[model samples]
Target: MLRPGSTTAPSTPLIAPLAAPRTARPRRPGLKAAALAGLLALPLLLPATSRAQETTAADASQPTAPAADAGGGETRTEVAEAKTAEARAAIAAAQEEDANDPLEGMNRAIFWFNEGVDTVLLRPAAKVYRTVVPDFAQTGIRNVLWNLRSPLTLANKLLQGDWDGASVATERFLINSTIGLGGLIDVAGDHGLTYEYESFDQTLAVWGVPEGFYLVLPFLGSSTLRDAVGFGVEAYGDPVSRYLSNTHDDWASYTRAGVYAVDLRAQYLDVLDDMKRNSVDYYATMRSLYRQRQNNYIRNGKVDPDQFPSIPDYDSK
Candidate 1:
C-alpha cells in the first residue's frame, strides 16, 4: 500500500504564493544531461517486467478448457478477444482526443521536467525530512492544515448544490479540526470525535468535470485541464501562501516547496500506472479522467465510484 504522507492532505497546505514562481528549477551544468540519462535509463530497469509480460501472454495463449466444452469455448474466446479489441479502440480514441489538444502536449513537457527536478533533488530532501521529523507529527501537522481548509471546500460544494457533500465535508472538517486540536488549536481522540478523510481528487469529482484526458506534466503527472486549474486556484487560497507572503522569508518558501513536492509525488505514484494502462493516448486519458473528476466534484462534491479507472492488470502481477 502507498504510505500515508502521500496524499495525506487534499492539496498542498502550502500555497503557491509562499513559493517561488512556477519555473523549471535551474540545474547545474551537465546536470541536465545526467537527468536525461536517468530518464532514459528508467525503462531499462523494466527488462524483468517485460519478460514477465511475455510469460503471461504465453500462458494466456494456452488456455485451459473443460473436456466437454472445447468447441463452445473457442467461440467464447473469440468473442472475448473481440470485446478486448473494442475496448482497446475506445481507449485509443480517447488518447487521440488528448493528443489533438495543444495544451496537453505542453503540459506533458512540463510534467517531465518537474519530475526530473523532483527525482534528482526534492525527493532526496523529502526522505531526509521524513527521517528527521517524527512521522506521526508530520502527518498530524498535515491533517491539521487540511481541517482548517475544509470550510472553503464546504462552501464550494454548497454553492454547487451538493448538500450531501457539503454536509460530509463540514462534518469531517469539524471533527478533524476540533479533535485534531483548533486543527493545532483542538486533538482528535482526546476530544472524542472521529472521521475519515477524503482525497483531493475525490473532491474534484464532486465538482462536476470530465475524465480521461491524460497529461504528463513536468512537475505534475497525468492530470486533466480541470485538475491543473483546480490546483492553481487552491494554491491561491491556501493559508501557507498568505503566511509566506507576509513573512517574505526565502527559506520558508523553500521549505514549503519541498513539502509540497513530496506530498504531490506520493499521491501521483498511486495512480500513475492506472493512467497509462487505461488509455492508449496518455494525454487523452489524463484529460478524460481529470475532466470527469472535476465534473463529479462540481455536481456532487464526490467522484462517482465507477468513474475511477482501474489499474491495468500488470503482467508482472
Candidate 2:
C-alpha cells in the first residue's frame, strides 16, 4: 500500500513506545503554611489548653492528691500539705454564698436592704396585725385573696392547655365568690374541689423557658430572668388591678397590696425566724430552698424531702 517514491515509514502505533505518566511529588505543607495553620487553630486550642492547665493546677494544688513516690515512696512534706490547706481555706472564704447566683453581690445587698425595711417597719406592722386581727377574720381575708387569684390561675391553665384545670378553677371561682360569700369561705374545698393554681411564671416554665439565673428581687425574694418577665405579664394581666384602675380606685390597689404583704409576712414570720436560727448561711439556705421548691413547682414534681437537708420546720408557706 506504499507509493513507489514514498520515503516515509509506515507508522506502527502498535510497536510505539507509550509515554510514561508524569509522577507528581505530593506537596507537603511548607513551614510557613504549617505555622499559619497552627496560628489559625490556636484560638480553638487555647481555651481547651487553658482549661486543662487550670484543672491541672487545681489538681496539683490539692493536698488530697497523693504525691508520686520519692525514692522510697515518702509523701509530700507537712509544709506542702499546710500550704494546700491554706489555699483551700482561702478559696472557701472568698467564694460567694451561692455560686449559682450570678448576681450574688447585688442580691445580697438588696436582701440586706429588704431585711432593714422588714425589721424597721413591716415586721412590727405584721406583728400588730397578727395580734389585733381576729383569727376567723384573718382566715376570711386569706380565702378572699386566694380566690382573687383564680383568674390568674385559670388564664395560665388555659395558656398551658390544661382544660381540666381551667374548668376546675372556673368552678372554684364561681362557687366561692357566690356560695362562699365573696370567697370568704371554702365552699369549693368543702365540696372536694380544690385549687390547681398556676402562675404566668409557671406557664412560661411549662412552655419550656429555661431558668436563666437566680435573683433576689427587692421585695420579691426568689426569681429568675424568665420568672421576672412572667411577673411583668401577671402584673399587666391581673383582672383586679385592671378593674381598680378602670374605676379610678388606685388606693384600693395599694391597700390590697399592703394587706397581702403584711399577711404573707406574718404567716412566714415563724418559718423565716427558724430558718435564720438554724441556717449557717441564711443566703445560701434560702437560695437552695427557693431553687428547689421553684424547680419542683415548675416541673409539677413533688419536692424530695431529702433535697431539703435542713428544713427548719414549716409546712406550706
Candidate 3:
C-alpha cells in the first residue's frame, strides 16, 4: 500500500476504524401478544388499585388541607364534598328505614301473607274477571263505586271546614245520581265539574295529627296508623255500606267490600307489578308512594315544593 500511494502520505498503516454502535429495533406485538401482555400486566395494577383505595379511605377519614395550587385545591375540595354527601345520604337512608317502620317484622309477615292470598285467590279471580268483563262495563262499575263514595267525601270536606267542597260534592252527587243513571256514567265530570278525593285522615292531618307510622294491612297494601283509622271510619260511615248492613244481610257490606277490593286490585295490577319491578325495596317504595299520595290529597293534589317531590299534574292525573 505505501508503494501505490507514495503521494498519499503513506496510508495509515492498517488502521481499523472503531465499530459503530448497533441498536435493536423494537417489535410491535400482535393482538394476541398484546392481550397476553396486558394479562401479565394486570397483576401489577392490583397493588396500584389497592393503594388508590387506601388513599381514598385515608382522605375520607382525615380532614383535607388546601393544596398549594388553587385549582388543585378546589378540585380536591369538590371531590371530598361529593364523597361526604354520599356517605351522609347513606346514613340518613338507614336512619329513615329504622324510623319509618317501628313494626317492620309484623308488617313484613302480613305482607307475605297478603301476597300469598293474592297469589292463591284474589289474583286468579281478578284475572278471570278482567277477561270476562267488558271494558265499558268495568268502567261503569268503577264510576258507580266512585259515585257511592260521594257521601264520605262530603263528610270529610265538612269536617275540614270546606263548605264549597261540600257544596260541590252535594251538587255532583245529585246530578250524577239523577241524570247520570245512578252514576253508571260520569255525567258531572264530563261537564267540567271535577270532584277531588278528600279523606278524614287528611282532615286529622290538617288538625295537627302526625302520621304515626307506616302500616301494611291485610288485603290493603300500604297505610299509616292515621289512614287506617280514617279508613275504618270511612267504612263504617259509608252510605252504601250502611244501607247494605241495615236493610240487607249483615254480611252484605263485607261482600261489597270484597268486590271493591277485587276491582281495585284488578285495576292496579300493572301499576303494582311495575312498582315492584322497578323498586329496590318494594315495601319502602309503597310506603313512600302512599305518603306522597296522602300528602298530595291533603293539599288538594298540589305539590308543595318544600315538603314533597315535584310532580306536574299529580292530583288530577
Best by lDDT: 3
lDDT of 1 at 271: 72
Question: How does each model score on TM-score?
Answer: 0.48, 0.65, 0.69
- Which of the two candidates, 2 or 3, achieves a greater lDDT against the reference? 3
The positional error of residue 191 in candidate 2, measured at the CA in angstroms, is 1.0
TM-score of 3: 0.69
Model 1 per-residue lDDT tens digits across residues 22-124 = 4754556697888999999898889989999999999788856674388888888887787778767766665555344556557767766865786688666
Ranked by lDDT, the better of candidates 1 and 2 is 2
Model 3, 49-81: lDDT tens digits are 999999999989875565447777787788777
Q: What overall lDDT goes with each candidate model?
A: 0.60, 0.80, 0.81
Please write out the lDDT profile of model 2 over residues 1-317, one tens digit for every residue.
Answer: 55679888756455434574445434777899989999899899889989999999998776653333452244345545666677666556444333467788999998888888888989899899999999899989989988988999889989999998889999999999999999999899999888765787889888888768788889777788888898889889899989999999999998988899999898988899899899898888887777776768765676555342331232331
Clash pairs, model 3 backbone: none
Q: What's model 1's lDDT at 65? A: 64
Judging by TM-score, tell me the better candidate of 2 and 3: 3
lDDT (0-100) at residue 180 of candidate 2? Answer: 97
